[model samples]
Target: MIETKDKKWSMFGHILMIILSILSLAPFVLLLVSSFTDEATALKNGYSFFPEKLSLEAYRYIAEQWELIGNGYLVSIIVTVVGTLAGVMISAMLAYTLSKHDLPGRSVLMLLLTFTLLFNGGLTSTYIVYTQIFNIKDTIFGLLLPNLLMNAYFVVMLKNYFEHTIPSALLESARIDGATEFQLFYRISIPLSVPMLVTVGMTVALNYWNDWMNGMYYLSANSNIQSIQTILNNINENIRFLQQNNVGTAMTTADLPSATVRMAVAFVGILPMLVFFPVFQKWFVKGATAGAVKE
Candidate 1:
């Protein structure tokens, strides 16, 4: 009787989960369809999974401006790869140090780290610091060195993971064998923390890939260094401004695929992350779940 009851509940759970999954994916499906729909058709119909008219005008616009978009892609890819690798390495090193209980001033150091999450100097001060002090403005380093590079939250999560998940006895044994702290960290701790590394790396990659604010603020005068997000953002803003103030302008609203072009650009912007997530999905999911529960 219990076996039969369990099977019935399991079937119901599967059905519910499938329904929820479809609901979650519906918006993206509509966005993709709208991107393919003709500008006129998209204006006529807001957004739909199945559009009456299909067009390549949006993509054609992208093709015409491929030089700018291509440069954006190159910049974004470089920043994401470099930032993720550097951020993960730096964050892991910091996390490992904080995870050590015997370290002097550990509590005070953690307090300072946690304090940043609760409060921060406002935008004016932050911009001043980065621009005036660091001299990052109008440079590629502006995009890579901003607030997203190393996060306090990542440090805390990873610190907790290292402390609880990694056995203390193993470190003691390695120390007894005359292995240095650096050796233990590089050889043992790093190798053993693959799951957490992948999880954190993916998070960092997503942040860098989706970031436009950093590029917008710091590289305002340097369009050459703008990432895909910043470039696409500028394109969208220009499109909207032209659409709204089409009167007496040299460029006509009808000349642009206003609606579909933005959507297509967004689709292209997120395409890399869509591909990236699936490749690390298994490791990402495992690390997230494992880090939540204590042994």
Candidate 2:
């Protein structure tokens, strides 16, 4: 009887999870379908899982704006790559340093790091500092830096992984064998912390890829270094502005694929992440659970 009850519970759990999985995937499917949906049909009928008339008009519209889109892609790629690499290295190194209990001024450093996590200078102050002191505004660095770089929570996560997951004795043995601190970190700590690092790197990359606030705040709309998200946003805004002002070549706002284009823009924005995130999905899953269990 107990066995039968347990089996029933297991089946129920499986059914629940399957439902949730489908629910999670339904929006992406709808968004993809909507992007290819006919402008008139979509506008009249609203978005549907099975769009009545399929059209490439939305995609064609995007392709028509390919030059700006292409530049946005380039800038996003550069920022994601450089920012992810730099952020990961800095976060990992700092975390590794903090994990060392004997280091001088470690408490003070940790306090400062925690303070940042708790509080930040408001946007106005941050903008002034970056613009006046750092002078990153209107530059590629505008996209690369700002709030996305060097997350304090990520530092704490890495520090925990280094201290809890990595064997301290191994690092000590390397040190005893005359391995420099850098050598110990590079050879011993990093290799063992791959899962955590990959997880942190993925998060940082996503943050960079999806960011548009930095562009809106620091870079002008026409700035060549605007990221893909920023570019898509600009396109969306331009569409809205034109619609509001009744400005178009010949086609009225009513004739425009305004709604479908929004779906298309959203689809375009998330496509790369969808394609690439799954490749690292295993690492993400593993790393997320790595230091959770302490023995």
Q: How much lDDT does candidate 1 score?
A: 0.86
Clashing pairs in 1: none
Tens-digit lDDT track of model 1 for 1-295: 9999999999999999999999987877777888899988888877778899999989987888899889999999999999999999898899999999899999999999999889988889989999999999898889999845448888898899889887888878899999999998888788778888998888899999999999888987446989999988888887888889885455588868898998898898988987778888887667556544244
* Candidate number with greatest lDDT: 2
**TM-scores, all models, native as reference:** 0.92, 0.91
Error of 1 at 235 (Å): 0.4
Each model's C-alpha lDDT?
0.86, 0.89
lDDT of 2 by residue, 26-138 (tens): 99999999999999999889999987899998899899989989989989999999999999998998999999999999999999999999898898999998899999979
Model 1 — TM-score against the truth? 0.92
Please identify model 2 stretches exceeding 4 Å from their true place. Answer: 1-10, 283-295
